[model samples]
Target: MLFDTLKVSIVLVTAVTRWKGLETRFLLWKSLPSSIDRLQHFASSRMCASVKRCDLKVESPGFWDALGNLEDGGLDVVKKFFELLTSFPNLATLSLTALTLDPLKLQRVSEIHTLQTLIIHDCRLPRTFNKLSIRDLEVSGNPTEMFPASKEDYGLASFFDLNQVERLQVSKPTWGDPLGLFCTQSNSPISFSNMKVLSMPWTLSLSPTFPSLLTQCPVLEELRLFSQAPKTPSHSKFNQSGATTLHPSVAPHLKIFIGPDVCASTFTSRSLRTLVMASSEGRPHDIRKDVLPILTDIAFPGDLERLAFGVDCLSDPLLDYIAGSFKSLKNLSIFISMVDGERYSSDIHCRKMWISRLSSRLPSTLIRFDISTRFAGLNHSEDVSGEDLNVLMTPLSQRCKKLTAFTMSYQSAARGRTWAWRRSERTGYGSGQWVNTDEGVRQ
Candidate 1:
């Protein structure tokens, strides 16, 4: 079954790649000089099996990209790689699973205007491919030197520009020089006017006024920024010339803001309705001062319907502040993890105080309430009784009379946590943890 699953997945990926147009370039990596034609026949045989079973189209060839193992050698066979890309004029999506793009070859590949989605993992683009037009992009690789250093520098940037992209996903070791590569700089001032959904890791030094550009997206509804900063402190000066200050123009139509890291406090979006500031590390100052204030100060285009606060620690002041933020909060979620405490006893007191405070103020306003706990104690013997959990969540049940969804879970039981809320008529905990309404665990 495992072997069959692997085979089926590979065939499906190959089919999707071929459909999106990635066939010829894929053949290049499989065929060697001595027996290229015969190997092509073998690949055709495998493909024919799928074609016979299901309807498959193969009218035009595509850039089938399969990077050779780098341990064998480093970028010595790039000429052959380019030969593969040029074979397919209609290649739409190129998947590079390894860090092995020859700069010149990437540039040549970019010339194919039919390319729509460029999914790169570990591999950097050839120097020539920076300015190419790819609408949907996903990149996962090391942060060190991801972008081509200069316009003349033969690397990733030479083949592509991300300013016009509609959907983008970037997960790297860190966010280094985001504006220089992803956003526009002074010399390369560009606009992602059509960009809608963006997901990236956090950085303290993202280019200036980049936050304000969120207003530029006419239809942007979802924004998720994951935390990627190191635990150690590093104070770096923000260069004045590199800063892009937010003025009036930005993503005016944005509706959902999902920030998973510590961002600049100056972010302001008038149309934002759902704000999710989720954190695994509970920092008191960040929630009480930085994030919560943004929601209270700005006025949403519509009533701010949903709000969630996810952190390792739950504080009464933060809870009070959140209760005062909006008059029309429909859904609310809080995940609290204890910080360096021996037992759940000390944390429970703090948690109860916050929960009680929320209960008093949230009766009329809140429709849904989600609260979870994370107990500390390195030993595996720790346990949380069901009665205790019921007692803890008791306040939420009483205060939120209009509550459509009410949930609570114990951290000791939910260790190594990965859970979601179940979607039933009223409310249900899908995977064993707390979740609000139908959105499924708040992104």
Candidate 2:
């Protein structure tokens, strides 16, 4: 039912990162006075029956955010909007960015009993009157202690109650407090007792090592350490200081790891099913030495069902290791940079070399395969054109019979082209087409 009145409440979300600048992204919510009018205009549409997700952004006088801005408009508008918002029957997600809420507004937000996911970014804190019922949370910035705090209010309820969140995505944990999202004012460390999925960016150097964090997220099943940089992250202080390798008992139930080379090699989580690693090209020459040893040590024979690797170079030993180890693998993506020092051959070599061997070595059970040369900066690149895709991916299609979808990407700021093949609609096995990537990576 909400689909019929999408624009009334939905912000036609676009890729903020790729947008021209802050001005372009927040065109809808630029500043005060007009802020409420813009929102009223956006939500002025006739009410819908049931909405599943709600995304709102608000901030102080000096504030500006991506999707829109709600600055200096006062709390009255926010209060009025949430009043109408909380009446919705099935609201499940609330993403608030750059908000500078005081206690009254925080109490108003706490009244939304149906919220299951809360995403807060670059916000100043305002302690809430009610405990949060969110099971999933994503925080990109600190909900720093807010302004206008009474001298004695520092001892009030914890900034927000995150103990109920089972799936947490964090940017920095700021010591062991999980960015003070946990509702504890004491000096004791918080336990993420119900946590199953934890994702952190490579820049998380707030406090504690991976082991210490894992101790809190004892039952964490999926660990994601994604980052904007494909090469070794410059701020990898966690692994540099001592948490270089994980002990099996730390994240004992860990089944999926998607990030840098914090080796699972010691013994294993014993049942690691999906390992998607972006090689720390701190040492570009050791594609064989660094990755294979860990794969050889931890991943059980025939256990890995999906594997995606971003490597300095694609090597025989690595491909051979994958073929030998992940017999049941169903989906695979390999990103290689062919610059001499960057990794494999230049420009994913639009020539023959590894294409033939990669095709032959990939497991028969794989349903989808993606291979590409993803270099940042669009510079010093010996590039390939879209016309070269067939010559590049044809060998793969011929060899891997089970591949229902195949994608080969050569994306840059300007080119904006992406090529792929999917099972033909008529035959259900051998047809597909090219598509343009949304918002050019360079834009």
Candidate 3:
């Protein structure tokens, strides 16, 4: 079975090399149909060197047990895996998803010379996650609980210097337990001076000095701060927190800022041209209008081109204020969170009033509009008809003469699809190319 999978992989690889026009992607792990225990049978010495990239997920049901018992001599199986990785001196990307590895095994893997991208998911940083000099890095999923309880200092932030990390994504800590999960007690800011693109959950307690360090990243262009449920509040604030001053234009190179549920007022920057905010059900209704005024008050050197609002908040004033404020705004996006029973109001008048108010404030410079909502109370096809969606975007769409892209979620778009499908064909009103397919689009 193992030999057969390898033959197929090799054949597919050849096909990929031959058919340059093929748009489909082939996933070896999914296509390979053999138990991992027989891996040695497939990866002969010659083939080992030919493999360029490999992903070894630790969460597979019996994988850890197999790797841990690699030698019947214990742990050597993992050692052999590294041996294979080292053989591929040209390896570019290695992704380990939802896998846990022994620390000693990681230390040995770090010795490999030519690794460009390394990703670890739901895995503990084995001093090696830090020691490697990979150009791209991604650490996702929940923080592991098996880490030592006494050493919270082992948090990922302390493990490495992210100054050279180009694309960094430290996803939210879903289950925070066993103290040392994702943080250390330093209370000082960590730095990512060379990070070009950063996507971190809002709950991350950045060191107050983080902004100062960001200034070092002269090439940094995009910044995304996602708000996870708040982490233990940090006592540090701007002035009272005795920390170094945060430079006003530290992120001067930044052109985009995407975040939701964050008090936009807390941010002060001069280079931001694209702004995205995600609102949830518990969000403050007036935050849009309240925060927009403050955000606009801070002068940005560049023209604001795109503005997006996530639908967690029920307030329409926020949308209205945005339309009225940034006259140079080119694109607008609205994403609605799933409404709970309490938020569901049958009164169409209230809904109409909200839409009309938003429509009245539409800005003339806008070119693209995206509006989406998750209807938790009603099945879109069963009860809510498509007209509802048409009405929803009608107000915003009618005003933007340059409107080119209009996107909505599957359910949200389904409601608007009936009308939008037609309007989109006539006026090119369909969701943008990105709206139909972008991971974590709303969140």
Q: TM-score per candidate, in order? A: 0.57, 0.72, 0.59
Task: In candidate 2, list every pair of residues with a backbone clash.
Answer: 29-69, 312-343, 338-345, 413-442, 424-431
TM-score of 3: 0.59
lDDT against the true structure, each candidate: 0.49, 0.57, 0.51
The candidate maximizing TM-score is 2
TM-score: the better of candidates 2 and 3: 2
Give the least accurate 10-residue stretch of model 2, judged by summed lDDT: 4-13
- Specify the highest-lDDT model's number: 2
Error of 3 at 106 (Å): 3.9
Distance from true location, Cα of 370 in model 1, Å = 3.8
Model 2, runs deviating above 4 Å: 4-48, 59-75, 143-157, 172-186, 228-245, 263-268, 338-351, 374-399, 410-418, 429-443
Which candidate, 2 or 3, would have the higher lDDT against the true structure?
Answer: 2
